[model samples]
Target: MVRAGFLLSIFLSMALVPASARASDPDPWFGHDKFLHFSVSNGLAAGGYAVSSLFWEGRTERLIAGGSFSLALGAAKELYDMTGRGDPSWRDFTWDVIGTATGLALAWGIDELFFRSDARKPVEAAATPGGLAIRW
Candidate 1:
């Protein structure tokens, strides 16, 4: 719960930056490029979570891995843009963060809803007439 509140606060602050501060910015928040950033970040985050699940057993570790992977890629993109290939926009990064959070939340919720029970159930083995049967 504390983590959720903290994340919410960060998101709100990023989203609510004053209009006056962005008055001279060329990039619009609702631009098509922003959409791409959001979508790519979302996909990357979910993919990272799925990949990390193969290595990590804990939910928190998986979430961190996924979120960090997405954010690192976003930052790398921004850094590349800073090298004169394209315009670097904080708005794009903000969208990336939002998308990452959304993707992580959806993936985590799906995991909890669909996979939690299976993980929690204990495995049992019983001896049959011919062999041993294993069940979870």
Candidate 2:
């Protein structure tokens, strides 16, 4: 399915990291790479959760699937970097995890705010002459 292909693409991208740096002295962007990683990974995680929710039922399942995808992707990227000219920083991975948490919160908030299922609505009960009647 599309999810499988998407995951494969992510893994392929990680595998494509160059062994050597093509440019001299990559910019860290005012030493804010950690922040960038945090925010970007957070967004990626949220997006993954949102997408997974479309295919998976139940909040817990969606959260687990999306979170696992995000974490695996982040770890894979870091591991790939370690093999290249780029040094793998645990600090970056920490930020990625924080970002994933933020993303889950965001996804949950959005689901609660806009995508709540009506199936959870309470059923109504009416007293009848013989017994109680339930209405959904």
Provide the overall lDDT of each model, using Cα atoms, as 2-decimal numbers: 0.91, 0.83
The sequence of per-residue lDDT tens digits that candidate 1 reaches over residues 1-136 is 9999999999988888875466664788998999999999998998899899999989899999999999999999999999999899899999999999999998999899888945588878786678867676
Off by over 4 Å in 1: 1-25, 117-136
- In terms of lDDT, which candidate is strongest? 1
RMSD of each: 14.5, 18.0
User: What is the total number of backbone clashes in candidate 1?
Assistant: 0
User: What is the Cα-based lDDT of residue 112 in candidate 1?
Assistant: 93
Per-residue CA lDDT of model 2 for 5-116, tens digit only, reads: 9999999887777745456655453358888878888988888888998898788887887688888989998999999867788878888898899998899889878878
